[model samples]
Target: MHPARRSAGWMQTRFFVMKKKLLSLILTGLGILVLPNAALGAEPKTIGELVTKISNALYSAMSGIVLIAWIVIAFLYLTAWGSPEKLKTAHHAVIWAAVGTAILVLYKSIEPIIKNALGV
Candidate 1:
């Protein structure tokens, strides 16, 4: 096989392996967050309650993710060591993380309005 083609095949394999590992890590994290609630918490008796529970879980997960993002961005900023490119990348990450946090805040703010509107 051509060396170029062989290298491309190896890259693809590595990419797939990385994706698989990421997926498993995500699943494990979610299970750790969710399984205890499922096993120990009482079941929702109404649809509204169920929806509330799901939304609460989603909010918790998103908040955790945002916190992690901020930590990662902080690390990036600290390690940039005055390199322009690394600083730029860290700045971009900060902006994205801020946007994510804003969205979460909006969701939290509007959730009460929504629940009141729906009488849930």
Candidate 2:
């Protein structure tokens, strides 16, 4: 019946609601990304085709992850405001995201070489 206890309970309830919403949003995003590919794509007949399909799926997933990472980094930077430690953490996130993006680009650039090696 105390005001402090009521406020605490309200905060906990709000936290749970936010967590559930975030989880559902993530699941929906994943379904949107994965379901179409799984349901619409034709079955691969050759080893090369199978490898290519798997590689493409991985590339798509990684690209989505990188996009989400960048969004998180931006949120970190915004929330950091003028705090030195938070800003440092945000900078680190930015660096890591950049590294991930570079890796993705490198993988994409080498796709032709991979196909050639597989003689696809």
- How displaced is residue 112 in candidate 2, in Å? 1.9
- Pick out the ten consecutive residues of candidate 1 with the lowest summed lDDT: 31-40
- Among these predicted structures, which one has the highest TM-score? 2
Q: How many residue pairs clash per model?
A: 0, 0
Writing each residue's lDDT as its tens digit, candidate 2 over 71-97 gives 678767866759999999999999999
Per-residue lDDT tens digits for candidate 1, residues 79-111, read 676999999999999999999999998876766
Residue pair clashes in candidate 2: none
lDDT of each: 0.77, 0.80
Q: How well does candidate 2 score on lDDT at residue 80?
A: 74
TM-score between model 2 and native: 0.74
TM-score of candidate 1 against the unseen true structure = 0.63
Model 1 clash pairs?
none
**TM-scores of the candidates in the order shown:** 0.63, 0.74
